[model samples]
Structure formats: C-alpha cells, structure tokens
Target chain A: MTNTMTTRRKSNLTRGQLPKYTPWVVVAAAVVLAAAIMTLVGFSAFGWGVLAAILFTVGLTGISAAVEGARQAKDKLATCLVFGSFLIALLPLISVIWTVLVNGIPGLTFDFLFYSMNGVTGQFDDAAAAGEAPVVGGVYHAIVGTLLMTLWATLISVPVGLLAAVYLVEYSEGGRLAKAITFFVDVMTGIPSIVAGLFAVAFFAVVFGPGTKTGIVAAVALSVLMIPVVVRSTEEMLRIVPNELREASYALGVRKWRTITKVVIPTAISGIASGVTLAIARVVGETAPILVTAGFATSINFNVFSGWMASLPTFIYTQIITPTSPSNPDPSAQRAWAAALLLIILVMLLNLAARLIARFFAPKTGR
Target chain B: MSKQTSRAGDRIFSTTALMAGVLILVVLFSVAVFLLIQALPAFFADPSEITGGEGFWSYIWPIIVGTVIAAAIALILATPVALGVALFISHYAPRRLSQGLGYVIDLLAAIPSVIYGVWGITFLAVQLEPMYEWLAEYAGWIPIFAGPASATGKTMLTAGIVLAVMILPIITSISREIFLQTPKLHEEAALALGATRWEMIRMTVIPFGRPGVISAVMLGLGRALGETMAVALVLSTGPLILSLIQTGNSTIAAEIALNYPEAYGLRLAELIAAGLLLFIITLAVNMVARWVITRNKDFSGANA
Candidate 1:
C-alpha cells in the first residue's frame, strides 16, 4: 500500500494547491507583459502601473480559478483590490509630503523665520524673484499671532470644557439637562469653522459695534471650535476613572468635589492634557475663523484684545490668493510653501506629543 | 473639614460645573440666534439688491447647488476607497502594521486645510489639468465633462478632487473603528463554515459595519460641505454650470470666504445668510449621522 501511494501521481494534500511563490511569479510575469504592451503603445509610468495591476489581478484570479476554485479566486481578487485601495489612498499623502518638502525647504531660511512682513513690500519680493536679493520678510508676525491667539483660546476653552465634562460625567447622572448639554456639544462639533467665524463676527458686531476684527475675536471663534473637542475627550477620560477610586475616596470621608479634584482628575490628567493638546493642534491650523475674525495684518501685533492678527493659515492663504508681488509671484509662492511647512511641522509635533503623553502617562493597572 | 465648609465647597463646585455645562448650551443657542439676527437683513432686503439682481433665493440657489454637487462628488469618490482602506487596516493588514497604518491616516487628517488648499492649487490642479483636457476632448459628450476645460486647472472638478483627498481620512478612520469592532466569533463562525476570507467579511463584517459606514460617510459629507479654504483657493469661481470641467460653480463656504473680507453692508449680510444656510445643512447632516450612530450603539460594539 505504501509503495502504491508513493507511486501515485498526486497526493491528496497537494491536490488543487498552488505553490507559495505563485503570486510573486505571477506579478513578475505581469510586470514584463505590461511593459511590453505599454512599449507597443505609449510607455507612461501611470499607464504601466495600471496595466501591471490589472494584468496581475486578472492573471492571478484566472490561475487560481483554474488550479484551485472560484472561491479562492474571489478571495484573491478581494485581497488585491483591498491592498490596491490602500496604495491608491496613500498616493496623495506621499505626493503632498513630497511636494511640500521639495518646494518648502528652499524657502525655509533663517530670514524666513525671523523677519516680519511689516516693511517688506512688492519691491522686495520682485527683487528676490529677479535674483537681485534673497527672499525677504518672514512668518514671524504670523507665528506670534498664531501663538498668542491659540494661547488665549486654550485659556478660554480648557476650564469651561473641563468643568462641563466633569459635570457630564460626575454630576449630570444622565439627567435631562445633562442630556441636553451632551446633545448640544455634539451639535457644536459639527459647526462649520466658517460658521463659527460668522458666529463670532455676528456676536461681536452686535456688542462691540459693527466691525471688530482682532486676535480676541479670532480666539473666541477658535474656542468655539476647541470647546466641543475638549468636552468630548475630557468627558470620555473622566468616565473611565474606574469607579473604585471614587468610591474609596468617598469611603475616606472625602467630599464629592474633593474626591473628583484629587482622585479622579489626577488619574485622568494624562488623557485630559493630551486631549487639550489635540484641541490646540486642531484650532491652530484653522484658517477661515481667523481670516474673518482677526482680518489680516502685515505687521506683528501683541495685543489680542485690540489689533488685527495674521495667523499662519491666513498668511498662507493670502500669500497664495493675493501674492505679495503679482508681477513676480515666485517669492510669494516660496514664502507660502515655507509657511505651510512650518504649520504642518507645528501640527505634527503637537500630534506626536499628544500620543507620547497618552502612552507614557497612562495609569498603571496593577493592584 | 467642617460640614458647613464641605457643603459650601460642594455647592460651589457642582454649581460651577453645572454653569459651565449650561454655558455650552447658551453658546450654541446664541450661535444660531446671532447668525439669524445677522441674516435677517438679507431675508428682508430688496429683491434686486441681492447678488443675482433677482432675489435672495436666486442669489443663494446656485451656490447651494454648487456646494451639494461638490460634496456629492467628494462623497462618491471617497466612500468606496475609504471602505477599502478601512478594511485593509482592520482585516487585511498584518497585525503589527495596522496600528502604524492607522497613525499614517491620522497624520493625513492632522495636516491643515490651508496647506491642502495650497497644494491643490499649486500641485494637484496642475497635475490634473492635462487629464481634464483629455477628458474634455474624449468625454465631451458627457455633460459633466463638456468642452472648454479650465485654463488654470481651477475648476469645480479639481476642487471636488481636493475635497475628496481632504475628507478621505475622516471616513477611513471612523469606518476602520467600526470594521474593527466586528465580532470575532461571527468572523470565526463564517470561516468555520469553510467560507473564504472575503466571504466571511462580506457576510459578517459588512452587515455589522453598514450603519457605521453610513454614518461615517455622512460625517465626511458634512465636512466636505463646509470645507472652505481648499475650495476657495483651488476653484476659479464663476456662475453655476453643468460642466464640472469649466471654470465655474462656487460653493457657499468658498463664496463666503472670498467675499467676506471685502464685503460690507448687504453683501456682508448676504454672506452671513449663506453661512446660515451652510450651518443648517451641515447641522442636519451631522444630526442624522449622530442619530444613526447612537441608534446602532447597542449592537455595534463601536463604543466598546
């Protein structure tokens, strides 16, 4: 019987099975065939890639169906498509970063970081574009304005957001008022940034006369966007504080307020801090609200309550929309790209910091 | 601590918290009321005084159509790819690579809108202009791709593409979370029945994740509807037209952003009214999305 089995043409285990290297071989063959086909027509990188992908998919599916079964073929097709989708989605991200880096690095000079656009005029940009001078002016004023406005926004949003979250998780007990607050907060999250800008404009226009565009106005608009995020995240963090800790505090004769302030908040502080940082990151990049609320200023302004401000987002917007030198837009474009790079860096750093804080500061679960 | 002191502290603390909660409600209420008050002038303004020289409805109608068309384009383009990406992350990707992929997508979301706008006008539009020309040449019979492609590559179609890229991460992340929430037992059961991976996912995961995917798409729709900077910077605004390849069709958010800086008197109010319309539209979309999410919360395992 063993001799007969050994002499058999095929084993049961190996029947209808493709080798593990089948896909790689198929892909390699697809690439060669795709290239030959493309050469016969017009060879373009995009066309070659698309053709290779198509050939690979069809070839693999056909081979699998012939060797294995339709089910395995279908599974292979789905896997290919799913993986293809991921690669396609990644195209824009990779392109965006590549474009930014290539275009932004040249313009991101020391002068670009330090000098304000206060005295810099079209002449300067024109001269720079003509290679008569280095690219003049910088994002200093815009950076200062962004920092000041964001600081004020954080100051306004955090206390209110934290307290509201505390109320939702600790005091509301899912009551009618709490439900209403929770619902509205969710609604607030959906408010368009432009609409938030309009709200600030309308609110301040009614109070402080017709036209009041200042850093504070922009800060208020940002807080409108920032508050809901803070409330939602803080509320989640506070809710997960493990009821035992609060109960223990209560058992120790600590008051509700004291228990929350001492035990609950301390436990969830990491999450709350990270949430706040993310909120800041979110609002820092907002353009529409700042554009409408703070208007635009070429010069640096320190006063959030009074003068107009130029944020990094609006700076990039205005530079692109209405370049400093319409006659020679290269320098303006360069500056705009550099500012964009800076803004992206700021946002990325904040995101990284938030993640690091969340990972490192998580409370130990050990008893 | 003394009982009276403790009582005072508790009263103060709880009341302060309650007041903060109430303040949020008040702020939200005021946003609507204040916008309404500002927009009332446009509603009552003379018919000929509005932008279209006809009526407020006529003035706003084209932009509304433009906004809806842009958002629809974004939603249509992003939904399938986003679902694929979500499935790739939650199911197809190797275990160790999934979390890193999630972060990469989140990074896409982290980039500011203005940078997207800049990239759109400078890079994406330039890259797509040739394709738009090719489409206009070959597909001119299709009304949407009709001839006379944009010279600057700044058209509604281009803006829509940029918007698609912008909203992709939102849809992907939300859908990824929901897809990951599919019950392992159901997946295993489907597999145990000799089903393939695709069949298992189709039978178990897709059904469970349908509501989540819908809500995710809706949220992305809301975002695309209100996205301002990208459309404003990318689209070369003109009156509404059927041909998306043309340099026409302006969205509400883009219109408001471009005009608000120089606007005064009735123009400002008109823009504010436009903003009100945008606010209402997004609000409705988001509310429905949230309602869908909350309704499915019990069985979705999303919250868990």
Candidate 2:
C-alpha cells in the first residue's frame, strides 16, 4: 500500500504550484543534450535536429507522464506529434530554400546578370579557361524570353478565361452544356504541362510546318495550361459578386451586357487580377512545354513569331543537363542554380503582389 | 429601339461566352487528336526499328512500369505524413498556427517544379545516401531494398522520395481543407460522449474525410505521374526495376523532357506517344477524382 501510494501522482494542490514553464525547460535541456551527443558522435546537422526533436518528444512526454499523470502525458504526446509532423513537413521546404540560396548566390555577377550570351561560344567555353568564370554569360535573353512568352500567354488566356467564367456564372442557368464544360475543365486541369507542349508542337507541326519552334508556340502552350486555373478562379470570383448587385443593376433598367461589363466585372476585377497573376506564376516556371515548343536558344530572339526563344526554365534545363563547358561544368551548374533562384524570386514576388492586390482592393465590409 | 439594342447586346455577349466555353472543349479534343496523329507512326512502326532495342514495347513498357512504381512510392510515403500534417492543422494546432502552417504549405505549390528538380539533384539525392544504405543493409531480403545502394543515389527510389516531398503539400492542403470542413456538431457530439480526442477525430473527422482523402491522393498521384524535371534530374537512364536498387529508369513525362531536345523523327514521335499515354492516364484519374467529389456532394457533410 505504501509503495503504490508513493508511485501515485501528486495532488492537484501540490502540482498546480509547480512551474508552468517546466516543459520549455525540458526542451532546452533536450536541445543541449542532443547537441552534445551529436557532436560526440560526429553526426550531421540534420541528425542533430532529428535527435533534438526525438529527445524533446520523449523528454516532455516522460516529464508530463511522471508529474502531471497519464491524461496529461497523452495530451503532451499529441502536441509533440503535431509539432513534429509540422517540422517534418517543413524540412524539405527548408532544404529547397537553403540549396537555392547557397548554390545560387555565387552565380550572380554583373556580367552573368547583364549580358546576353548571344555571341558567346557554346561548343567550347573559352572564358571558363580564362577564369572569367560563370562562362561569360548572362540570362538576359532568357529573362526577355520568359517575360515575352508569359505576357503573350496571359494575353491569350485572360480574356477567354474571364468571359468563359462570366458566362458560366451569369448565363449558364445550370444548363447541361455548362455542366459539361465545367466537368471537362476540371479534367483539363490535370493535363500534364508536357502534354500541352506536345499539343502545341503537333498543332504547329501540321499548320505551319513540321518541327516549327517559336516563343508564340510556347505562349500558346502556356495559355493551354493557364486557362483552366484562370477559369476556375475567375468563376469563383465572379460567382461571389452578390446577386443583389446584379438585381440592383437590372432594377436600374440596365442591359445584361452593360451590367456584366460595368457592375459585375468592376466588383470582381480585383480577385480576377489576383487569379491571373497566380496563373502566370504557375506557368512561368514550366520547362517541359517550353523545351518542346520554344526550344532552347543561347542568343536572345526578340520576335515570338519566329525562331527559338530562350526562356529561363529551358535555359536552366539545358545548362544543367548538358553544360556548354564539358571540361568544367561547375559554371553551368552555377548558372542553373542562379536561374532557379531568379525564378523562385519572381514567383514569390508575384504571389506577394497578388495577395496585396487582393487585400488592398477588397471591398470593405461594414462593421 | 433601346430594347432591341439591349436584346442584341445580350445575344452577342452570350454567344461570345458560349464560344469561349466551347473553346476549352475544342482544345482538349485537339490535344488528343494531335497526340494521336503524331504517335500513329510510332504505334504502326516495325518493332525491329525502335530505339533502345527489343522493339517499341521494351522501350515504352518499362517507362510505364517505372512511372507507376514511382508514383506508388510517392503515394505510399506521402500519404501518412500528409494526413498527419493535415490532421495537425485541422484538429491539433492552435487556430492561428494552423492558418499560418497552411499558408506555408501552399507556398510549396508555388515553388516551381524545375526548382524542385534542382534541389532534388543537388541536395536530396546526395543526402539520402545513408538512408538507402541503411535500408539496403537491413532490408536486403525485401526485393525493393535487396541490391546494394547505388553510390550515385539516382535510382527510381530516390526519384520517388523527391516526388513524395513534391506532392506532399497538395495532399496536405486538400485533406486539411476536407478535415476542417467536418460537421462541427458531430465533433461536439463525439466529445460529449466522453470519447478521447483521438477517438473523437477517428470517429468524426476521418470518416467524414475518407472520400476527400482518396481524391486528394489521386490528385497527388496525377501530379506525380506527370512531374518531369524532378524525376528527370534525380533518375539515371534505362529500366532498372528488376534490380529495384539499380540506378536508372524514367517516367514517360520525364522521358519527354530529357529526350525532347535532341530528338528528331522517330525519337520525337515515340516521345509524343509516351506523352499521349500520360495525358490519357491523368485525364482518367482526374475524371474519377471529379466524379468522386461530385458524387458525394450530399454525403460530404457540406450544409449546402
């Protein structure tokens, strides 16, 4: 009886007085212990983190189990699991950020940033031997191509997607054709980007000539990929433009077209802009379709209508896969990483701007 | 006169809208037709003349197998972790933390696939060597882990792991959305019945989200099947599934990306044929995903 009683947890009155920050203290101790062990064993940094995480989990649960009792232990375990799972989910994301920054920074210099590699030798990277490293090149042409192609894609996709969305919400009235269109669009949403590229190639192959490659073709490919997303998002935005507003427009004796153009569109324009921006961000990193359609070029091709264009994605792809300097591909790898960083930055900035646009332009709700 | 103008304006806008909607169908149909037209020669060609020997079947079949196996690996690895994260966000995390975590996860989707490839090749493949070796040593009897771990770490297994990381976010976000939408009354009722927190979740949330979870996985599978660069960058070439631990193989879409640059004539045609297969597979998977979502709309616990 005495042994069992001694093993029992303390009463609430006594335990309540215990330090509330005890768990954090345990965590700090776990981290230090984990670090000491990792250093002694010569483990990697990742291993140290994993060890610390495990120690924290085990330590907290044990501490809670001993002091606070079983129910509290279970709760603490659940909490630890949640935090641990989140950390695990975040690991690769952290890896991505770290790798891009670490490997990408060394590749960014003035010449690498500014000059187009139009006249640069491709078969042999002579500049590499001269130690004028990074292959004496810049992604200027690729940057121009990416912007030019994406602009064309946005141009081609936005109006069509917007109108299609407006029609679905405003005029479909739940018709079968509308239903079918919605269903097909959902399916189209899953078509591989590479497949879209193939479609463009086949389209141009028959229409213009076999093996035709150009930025316009790539733009069309991107447009194919972007339309479904745009339609889906725009449709959601347009649907939410309160029926009361449409009724009010109708009550004012306005035509359907005019009401849609002025009231409905004006109300949803912000969300629409955000959606379009997101669609652009999504397709701008595409390499497969561009690889198939636009093809890679070392020099900048100003015209989208003819000639192969060098987009950032395809540029990175070629640089990584088949470095121009066979003797030392380190410069090429550096360039690829740099291009990747630029692409990530562009996408991230676009996302931020889209969120800002959505927030800034949102209609104020009456409190 | 004003009425006539208004009516004519309505007609024009409606027609334009109809045309735009119909254009989506046109594009979908034309992609199928285009792929078919381009691939017909490859399908009809003499088996003896195909690239990589043993005829077209040898070249194409292995790729299809590799794709399925890789996606299977991704699905297996990602599903549980994604579910845990989703559940953590939906049920466990503080409300503020859950929202922030969700936003962070969605950013995973925004990071470009090519960037994923870069990371996969430059970091993940190298970092996972110890794990592969460990598995090889301990689980040698298991066919998948039987042979020696490749020094390069460019095997299909590694590619799948990269893909697992790539697809985790989408699955997490979708299932998290579904789990979050569980009927609140059901949850309260379960709790009121003296069920443990996990029990309440198991009974209420997981049941409600089962269909959504399946659909989310299917969507992830769709993404994994079509992912190009990550697979291309992480994998070496050739079919190595029989050896399981062998360092080379390719998915159909990855093949397209890797081969498209230098491809001409039959090579390009064969690649397009592969793309066609990928298109059909994703299309079917997506159709089923839509069907699953729409079919259970009433049962999905949404009030509306």
Candidate 3:
C-alpha cells in the first residue's frame, strides 16, 4: 500500500494538475500585504492605499483560484498588462484633447474665425480696443495659405509618385531599373523633413538669390516629404491587384497601359485616394519645415510664388512662441489654442472624408 | 505595314516614358547631393570663414550621437507599450471595445506632430517636472539624469518621451494587424495541447508576429530619428551633455531647423552637409525595415 501510494503521488505531479486557486491566493495575499504597507507609510489619500490593497488581494486570490481550479492564470496576467498599457496610452491623448478644447474655445467664436492679425497691437488691448469685441483676430489668412500650399504639394507629388508606382508594378517585371527605383524610393522615404526643407531653401537661394523665402519653395519642400509616402503606399495597393485580373484583361486583347488604367487603377482607386489623403495629412501640419523654408507671416498671401505666407501650423507656432500681446498673454494663447483646435478639426475632417470616399468608391462585390 | 514609322513611334514612346521616370529619380537624387554640397561650402570657402571654430569631425560627431541616442531611447520606451497595445487590440479585448480603442489610437496618429509639440511645451512640461526632478535628485549618480535642470521643460528625455507618444499609434496599429494574422491552426493547436491563452499567445502568436513587430519598430524608429517639428519645439539646442535628462542637446533635424535661416555661405553649406548625414541615417532605417518585411518569416500567413 505504501509503494502504490508513492507511485500515485508521483503520477499526479507529472500530470501537471495543481490546485487552481494557488496563484490567486498568493496574488491576493501580496496585494493585501502591499496595501497594509502603504497604509503604514501614510499613503491613504482618496483611500488609494486601501483600494490598491483590496485590488491586490482580490487579483491574487482570483489568480490563485484560477490556477487551482481552471488553469487560466496565463491569460489573467496578459489581461492586466494590456489594460495597464491601454490606460497609460490614453492619459496623454485625453489630456491633450481636453486641454486644447478648453483653452481654445474662447477664441473660436465667429469674429475670431474671420479676422486676421492685421493691425492688431497688444493682446488684451487689441481685442478690447478693436472696433469689434474680444478675440477679434482670426486665422483666415493662415487657413488660405495652408490650403494653397498643400494643394500645390499634392499636384507635384501625386503624378510623380503614382507614375513611379505604375512603372514598378505594371511594367518592370522586377527588372534592374525597377530594382534601382525601388531601392532609391526606400531611401527617399527616409529623408528627414527638415533636410527636405533645407534642400528647398538652398535650391531657391541659389536660383532666386540668397535669403529667398517664398511660399512656393515651402510647397516644394513639402512635396519632397510627401512623395516617398505616396510611392510606398501606392506601390503596396497596386501590388495587391490580382494577377488574375491583369491576365484576364490581357486575354481580352486590352493593351497593357490601357488595361492598367481602366482595370487595375479603377479597382485600386479607393486605396490610392485614401493613401494620398493620408500622405497629405501627414505633412500638412509640419511647422519646422515651413518655418525654415517659407518663414512666417501675419497677413494672408494667395500667391505661392512670392513673399511670406501664413499657415495654420506656423501661425500656431508664432502665437505661442511670441505672444502678440505680452501684457495680456492669455488672449494670444487662447488664439493659439483655437488655431490648434482648428488644425486638429481639419485633420479629422480629412480623415472622415477619406473613409467616406473609400467606402463609396470601393469596388462593389456581388452578394 | 510601315515598319520604319512603327519603329520610330515605339522608340519615341519608350524614350519619353523612360525619361520621365529617370527625371523623377534624378530630381530626388539631386535633392540629397545638392544639400550636401550646400552644407559643406566651408570645404569650398577660405578656412577663415568657418563659424564656430570647430573642425568638421568635432561638430558633426556630437549631433549624430545625440540623434542616435535619443532615437534609440525613444524606440526602447515605445516598443513594449506598442506591443502591449497591439496585443490588447488583437487578442485580449472584446471585439467592440477593441474597435473603439483602435479608432482612438488612429486618431492619435492623425493628430499632427506640431500639436504634439505645443502640447508638450504647455502641458507636459508642467505635468512631468516632478518626475524629472525626482530622477535628477535621486539618479544623479547616473550621468544622463545628472544635470542642471531647466525651468522650462526641454531635454533629450522629454524629446524621447514625446517621440514615444508620436510613434505609439503607428507601431500599435501595424503590430496589431500582424498579430491578428497569426495562423489560426497554430494557435488552436497550442490551445488544444493544454496551453493556456497567454501561453498560446506567447509561443505561437508572438513567434509568428516577430518579424512584423520588428519592421513596425523599425518604421517607428525611422520616424523618431528624422522627426523635426516635434524635436525643434521640445529640445533646447546646445552642445552635447552626457546625461539624457539634462536639458540642452540637439538632434540633426532640430539643428538644421534651428540654424538654417541665419546660416550663410560656408556655414549654410555645413548645415546642408549635416542634412546629408541625416538623409543617410533615414535611408538605412528605411532599407532595413523594408528588408525585414520582405523576409516573409513573420506575418506571412496573416494576409492569407
């Protein structure tokens, strides 16, 4: 009987069956003990010490019990870590949105939306003394400049990036030239945004005389930053087009270029559009590049080829860095905050529009 | 058939298409070369005109080191957080909850870097000061945490942290997609063999997702390394300090942004050369990431 009993105990250990509640018990004990220690150390603000103690005890008990009875301890730890990270990530995001919304709202009213910094003197004095009331200056010029510059950048990047993708996907068949292009595009994708800004500034400085700061140069700099993104994204989308589709078009006597234009692109148009939109959004709010290349301006200028032009990003940067009204800095900060909010809203709108376009234009599949 | 005319047409069409593509590539290439030459005009100029009295090696080396160190720290801090978030979205959370969380994360990605900069300055500075102070006070033994603290928050640590936040969403989204693509058969086998959920994730899921995660991290690293506006806003450009927590160091991009406007002649050229160095760094990062993705060792079955 003694020999049989010893063998049975050995078998049980080998089978990996243990008490389910073992881990949970330990966990609970540790938590309760930690809470006790915290309480001893005088950390009872908002009953946090007590709460931590309780949670610790409960979690430990649950984990031990789970191991003893259910063998589910593995998932419990992962769940804890995941939730912890989620909350940690949420902290800055929530803080940023809340802070911007709260601080920026006072200056986001109608008049503040329409006016410019033109002729505005001191922050508090200007707002109060302006023929209108408080929060008088708007981001109208900045808004226009941002739109015009971004539009020009889009024009320059899309054709080049798209055509390059086309050559890689439809034409090259993985030839030497295609490989070279691929390598270079990858390299180009990593080009520093500030370097792109520096390039634009230097190029124009040489061509149009030194200290030549114009909105067009800024647009070109933005294009340099944008093209790589467009190429990579577009290339991926094009690559996903079914080879069977291309073959089917070839079988139908459609010329290669014509087939690509009519079939492959149409099928990928939704993705291409979404990708382009994302690339635009990526570079739209670049402040440093703009500051370096385009410089900042208070009044709006429509022409991209000449003079200083205001953009929402530079506008926000200048307002915060050098408050218009030093005496009453609060109003200037308020305007800066408002501009930030507007920029965020603009990005969100672009995202939403892209999603809608994607859904609407996505190729229909029959039921 | 008019063979001569047809040949001429073919030649013209091919040449034109080739020229267009070649021109695009050339323009891109010139951007890099032109900046280098522009930045190094001191090489072309009289030695007397070089500003800052420093030799070529002295000036460029510190900035390169600063950029690399900050980017590495940012990647290290961000990787685990990104993986955790990715796992949460792909496997741990309920479907609807995960969807909502994912949307919020993407929105974070969409918010521009400048906004991050402004927020970093006004809010993060005040909020995170205590932590910075605590480090400086206690960990002063460590060179990085040891420093004369600035009243306004601008440091390598702060820049790294801001970069961490900036790249978190991107890394999480990509990693999540890769994790979700782990072969169901492999996971089910692990589960059926008495592996717990977390065990299944660790052994089967993580192994499958490794390459994808690596590429995502590389991409994030690339962005963090080359990031401009965010760094410019958060950092106080100065000579290199041994400690990361000490305020006053400059990354290559921040250096270019800060000094590009005032620099002239050879000084301007030197800045451009600095830009060329930055370009090379980014290019290496991008190429490595691309290679990682193409290896097909990770996340290959996910798309299927």
Candidate 4:
C-alpha cells in the first residue's frame, strides 16, 4: 500500500493545472500576434486593441478548456465579458468629458462669462471668424435668467413638496387618498420635460391668455418637474427616521404635528436638504421646457413675471440652431461650448455640495 | 388657553399637509385636462390646413414610429451591457473599488441631456460618419445598413446610440442594487454543490434578479422614450423612413422642440396634441413598470 501511494504522489494530481502567470503570458502573446495581424491588414489603434482583447479572451478560454476543463473555461469567459462590458460602457463617458474640456476651455474667457449677447450682431461674429476681432457675445443674461428661474422654482416646489411628504409619512397611514397621491406622484416622475412645458403652456394660455411668455412661466414649468423629485426624496428620508423618537415624543405628551416638526424633521433635515439640492441640479439644465414657456431673449430681463427670458440651456440651443452669424458659425459654436462648460461646472458643484452635506450632517448613530 | 392653542395648531398643520398632498393629484389631473382642451382645436380643424395637408393623425404617425424605433434601439443596445456592468459591480469588482465605480456611473446620470445633445451632434456624429460609410459600402445588402449613408452622420442610428448611453446608468444602478440583494444562503448553497462562480450566479443571482432586471429595463425604456434634448439635437429632421442609417426621421419630442418656437395657432395645438400622446405613452410605460415592482414587492430589495 505504501509503495502504491508513493507512485501515485510521484505522478502528481496537479498535472493539468495552469501556471499562476498563464494569463500574463497569454496577454503578451495576444498583443504580439494582434500587432502582426494589424500590420498585415490596415492598422488602427482601436482595431489593434479590439483584436488583442478578442485574442486574449479566446486563447485563455481555449487553453483553460483543454487543460482544466469546460467549467473553468466558462467562468473565465464570463469574467472577461463582464469586465469588457464595463470598459466599453466607460468609453463614451471618457470621450464626452475629454471633448467638452478640450473644446470648452479656450472659449471660457472673462468676456464670455461677464457680457451678454444683447448688442452683439452678425458683423461681430463675422469679424471674429475672419480673425480681425475677438468673439464679443457672452452668457451674462442667460446666467441671470437661469438663476432667477431656478430660484423661483425652488421656492415654488420646496414648500409643496415638503408638506406633501409630511402628509404621506406622518398623516396618511396608507389611506386611499395617500395611495392615490403616491401612485400619481410615481407617474408624475415619468412626465417628459417637454410635455411638462406643453402642460404649462396649455394651462397659462387659457388663464393668462395665449402667447404670454415670461420667466415666471418657465419657473412654473420647471417646478412641475422638480416637485416630484423633491417629494420622492423627502418621503424616503422621513420614512427612515426611527419610530422610537416619535414614540418618545408621544410618551412625553407631545402633539403629533409637534413631534414631526421638532423631532422627525430635525433627524432627516440633512437628507431632505441634500435631496432638494439634487432636484435643483436636475432642473437647472432643462432647455426644452424653458424654451417653450419663456421663449428666448438676447438681452437681460430682471422681472420674471414679465418679458421673455433666456436660460443657459436655451442660450446654447439658440446659438447652435440660429447662429449669430450664419455665414461664420464658429464664433457662435464657441460661445455654446463655453456656456455648456459653465453649465456643467454649476451642476458638478451642486452635486459635490449635496454629497458634502449628506456626509457631514448625517444623524449620529453610536458606533 | 394652551389646550386651545395646541388644537388650533394641529388643525392648521394637518390641513396644510393634506392640502399639499391633494394638490399633487390636482396638478396631474389638470395637466391632462389642459392638454386635452388645447388639443381640441387641432382635432376639429380641417385636414387640409394642417402642416402635412392631411389630418393630425397623418402628421403625427411618422414621428410616433420614429420615437418607437429610436427607443427600441436604445433598449436593445443598453440592456445587455447594463446587465453585464451591474454584475461586474455587484459580483466581480473588488469591494473597495465597487463603491467608487458606482459613483462614477452616477456622474453619467448627473450630466444634463443638453450636454449629451451637444456631444452627440458635434462629436459623435462627426466620428461615426466614416463607420456609417464603411457599413454602407460593405454591409449594404442588409436593409438597415443599406444607406446612401448620411454625409453628416446625423441619423436615427446615431441618435439611438446617444440615447443608449444616456440610459445606461439608470439601468445599471437599479440592476446593481437588486443583484447585491440576492440571498446569501442561496449563493452559498450553489457554491457548496461544487458549482463554478458563473454557474452559481446563474443558478442563484440571475434567477432572483430577473424580475428586478425587467422592471429596471422598463424604467430605462420610459426614460429613453421621454428623453427630448438629445434626440432633438442629434437627429437631422426629415420625413420618416425605414432605414436607420439615413439622416431623416423625426421623433415627436424633437418635432415639438424644433418647430414650437416658430409655430402658431393650429400648429401650436398640433404640437400640444403630440405632447399629449407622448405623455400617455410614458405614463403607461411607467405604470406598468411600477406594477411589476409592486407585484414582486415581497422578493425585491428595490423599496429598501
């Protein structure tokens, strides 16, 4: 028996196992083979990379199946596919950011941020394109319009959204009315931004008379989109507030509303605030709704209740669609890219702020 | 006196909260009502007077088909890739890297649609023109690839691709959350049976995640259907055609956005009517998605 066992051990059960560095070796081989193939055909970097990845995957899977077995090969194939999908999904994101940065930075000058397109004309863009002058128009009025409209939208949405959330969590108790509201709110979240614009237009056209476009109308349109987001986020936060806190308030003879106001809201305030900021970020870049509701203006308009207004997104759209100089669209395209950069900056800052607020002000739970 | 004041305060507070909740329902109701009222004129108007010299239905039909084709392409391209991405984050990725990767994906969501529009029109279209020409030359026998291919590459296929990118994050995040919530016991049992990692996942995680994945894809479909600015900016406008590689075919949202600025009277009502159609389509899609979620509420971690 001892002699037989010794002979078996000498033969080794690890005969079919792959070396630890097999994948690395396979990758190197695949790269070299892919480059040779690419040279034979017409070579492109993207094509070379694709060939290398395919060769690496096939080579490793085939070798594994031949030696280790089919199951291991399947596992390896799955891993490659999942990782490859992630890399492919990331390509568009990287390209978009790089493109925006490369094209946007040069157009982002002091005059572009501080001046409006009010007095600028085709002649200026024409001259700028001819290399005889600097680009003259700016996004100042658009910036003001965006801020004012977003501010008013927040004012309109927050109170309504907050109260609706309060009712849903504290008062509703899954009643019929509450269920209806909940369902409709979910439905509301799916409303197209442009449809919301149309709703605002249809509503105002009847009451305020047709063809009345203003910053206030744009604000109303934005609020329709913003309110549902705020309500959903606030409701989630409120529901997570520990029931013990509310019970403790009740045990101390506190009123229901008072307990909600004083205890529950305080505990969830950080989440609600961050959620509101996110909602703002979502609406701040809306172009279609604002375009249909407020129309566009070249000059700054301070009063939201009167006059057509221009937001950052509409400014970008109009610039691209109807260039200040049709013959030379480069200047107009430059302004659009610059405004896009500014809008992206504003959105990223808001997102960062929301993250910071959520992290720093989260309710303490003893570790 | 304190009792009286407390009672009054409760009354006021509760009433205000109730009113706010009711207002949401009212707003939704009014949106449908107002749209219908405005759209009545277009329906009643003479067919000859409409933009196409036909009725509203004829004018709207092609764009409706265009919208569906674009959204279908988006869904088909996005669903598999999104599922793969979700699996990577939930199962294959290192724990430390997964959270950061998830955040990076969410950043894709936060970029506004207009930026996507600009990127699609200026960058993607220009880059893909060559590929379209190549496909037209080599794959021309295939009906969809049969193109006197677009010179500028502003085609339905390009818009669909942009839409695919736009909705990828939504589907990925939702599927990731559901994939993470697969029961630990089931996974361990599969592994204990000497299953490979992929087999174990197929037996446990995928089965558990199937409904959740379906609902997530549906929600992504709803978003893609309703998405406006990207399609508006990316696709070149013309009458609808069968080939996706051509520069023609307009979506309902894009039609409204491109024309509403200069349109007036019946033209305005026609656009509003089209908006109503879009609203109904999205509403139905979202409702079905929600119904699926609620039906599977017991098994899903979606609500949590």
Name the best candidate (by DockQ).
1
Candidate 3 accuracy as lDDT? 0.79
lDDT per residue for candidate 2 within A309-333, as digits (tens), equals 9989888888888887777777778
The full ranking of all candidates by TM-score, starting with the best, is 1, 4, 2, 3
Q: Output the lDDT of residue B27, model 3.
A: 69
Instruction: Tell the DockQ for candidate 3.
Output: 0.52
- Give the Cα error of residue A284 in candidate 1, in Å: 0.9
Collision count of model 2: 0
Q: Which candidate is the best by TM-score?
A: 1
Instruction: Report DockQ per prediction, comma-separated.
Output: 0.85, 0.70, 0.52, 0.81
Better of 3 and 4 by DockQ: 4
Q: Please identify model 1 stretches exceeding 4 Å from their true place.
A: A1-9, A12-14, B301-304
Model 4 over residues B1-304: C-alpha lDDT tens digits? 9978888888899999999999999998899999999999999899998889999899999999999999999999999899999999999999999999998888888888998999999999999999999999999899888879999999999999999999999899989998999988889999999898999999999999998899899889889998999999999989988878888899999999999999999999999999999999999998898788767976565445
**Predictions in order: lDDT:** 0.93, 0.87, 0.79, 0.92
- DockQ preference between candidates 2 and 4, better one: 4
Query: How do all models score by TM-score?
Result: 0.97, 0.93, 0.86, 0.97
Which segments of candidate 3 are over 4 A away from where they belong? Answer: A1-58, A61-75, A123-133, A240-254, A326-328, B1-24, B43-51, B96-100, B297-304
lDDT of 1 at B146: 99
lDDT of 4 by residue, A85-159 (tens): 898888888888888888889999998888899989999999999999999989999999999999999999999
